[model samples]
Target chain A: GAGVSQTPSNKVTEKGKYVELRCDPISGHTALYWYRQSLGQGPEFLIYFQGTGAADDSGLPNDRFFAVRPEGSVSTLKIQRTERGDSAVYLCASSLMPNSPLHFGNGTRLTVT
Target chain B: GESVGLHLPTLSVQEGDNSIINCAYSNSASDYFIWYKQESGKGPQFIIDIRSNMDKRQGQRVTVLLNKTVKHLSLQIAATQPGDSAVYFCAEKGLDGATNKLIFGTGTLLAVQP
Candidate 1:
């Protein structure tokens, strides 16, 4: 794709339900990242993937949050037992390298009721 | 516990005037800085970037100045336009034990007046 793409622009899930957000990165890019932006706040890093392997998951708030990049191009973020606090905009970005400029997707706005 | 912060939460500028947005980072290990512009309900777009090795970088009408001595970063937009009105965010990348991580600061809302 020309830019990073995220699916399901908006999602409203019930509390304690599972939700999954998807991200399709630019072609030929090897680095992908997930960040969450809360109201009135900057984006917070969640996880970063280098190819198919997760290089860093330390930023994940808890064990309930998980992400995967099966073939190193498309990634999915899964949240189990979602809470109301999970409501936020989840942004996906991809870069040619670790230090390269990041291209971001419009993001998936998740509103957990 | 990286605290990247903006000096001002909002900036209003006249169209065709030069606008400056300031940011500060507490982590001295940060070696890279980037400026991003985000419109309402949209993703952040890359504006410009500067490496710590250099003090200044310019791209089109955008200029980024980095002051390692004071750990400050500034973005100057020349001939600001109405389309330039957006939320500006500054991000820092550190090279200590933390790598491949960019910490973003609270953005500044830039409003351009005619």
Candidate 2:
């Protein structure tokens, strides 16, 4: 793909339901990032991956939020027992390397009812 | 926890005027900064970036100024257009021990009226 791509541009789920968001980064890019953006706010870092392993997961809000990059390209963010506060736009970005300019996707808007 | 913050929550400018967005970061160890523009129903797009060593950098119709003394960063857009109306964000990447995370500020909404 020309840029990072995220699946299911919009998702509506009930509270306490499990939801999974997928991201496919640009080919050959080694770094991927996940962020959460609330209404009227900027994107907040959730996690970062350097290749197939997560380099930083400190930004994950709690145990309910988790992300994985299995092959260093496609990634998935899973939220368990979603709360109303979890309703936000989930963004995915990729860069050639850490500290490089990130290419972002349109993002998946997840609404927890 | 450390964070980046914007001085203003909203900015309104007339078309063809220049717009300036300001941000203040508390982490001195941060070495890289980037400005992003986000439109409604879309993700943030990269605008410009500046490193800590440099005080200023310019791009197409956009310029970023960094003042390490005050830990302030500003993005100046020349000839603002109505199409430029969007939310602007400032992100900082720290050089501190093994943390390559980019921390983003609250964001400033820019509204350019015709």
RMSD of each: 3.7, 3.7
Docking class of 2: medium
Candidate 1 segments whose C-alpha is farther than 4 A from its true place: B1-8, B95-98
What is the C-alpha RMSD, rounded to one decimal, of candidate 1? 3.7
| Candidate 2 ranges with C-alpha deviation above 4 Å | B1-8
Q: Write the per-residue lDDT of candidate 1 for residues A1-113, one digit (tens) a residue.
A: 38999999999999999999999999999999999998668899999999999998889999999999999999999999999989999999999988898899999999999
Candidate 2 per-residue lDDT over residues B38-99, each given as its tens digit: 99998899999999999999999999999999999999999999999999999998766488
lDDT of 2 by residue, A8-113 (tens): 9999999999999999999999999999988777789999999999999999999999999988899999999999999989999999988789989999999999
lDDT of 1 by residue, B33-79 (tens): 99999998999999999988999999999999999999999999999
Residue B36 lDDT (model 1): 96
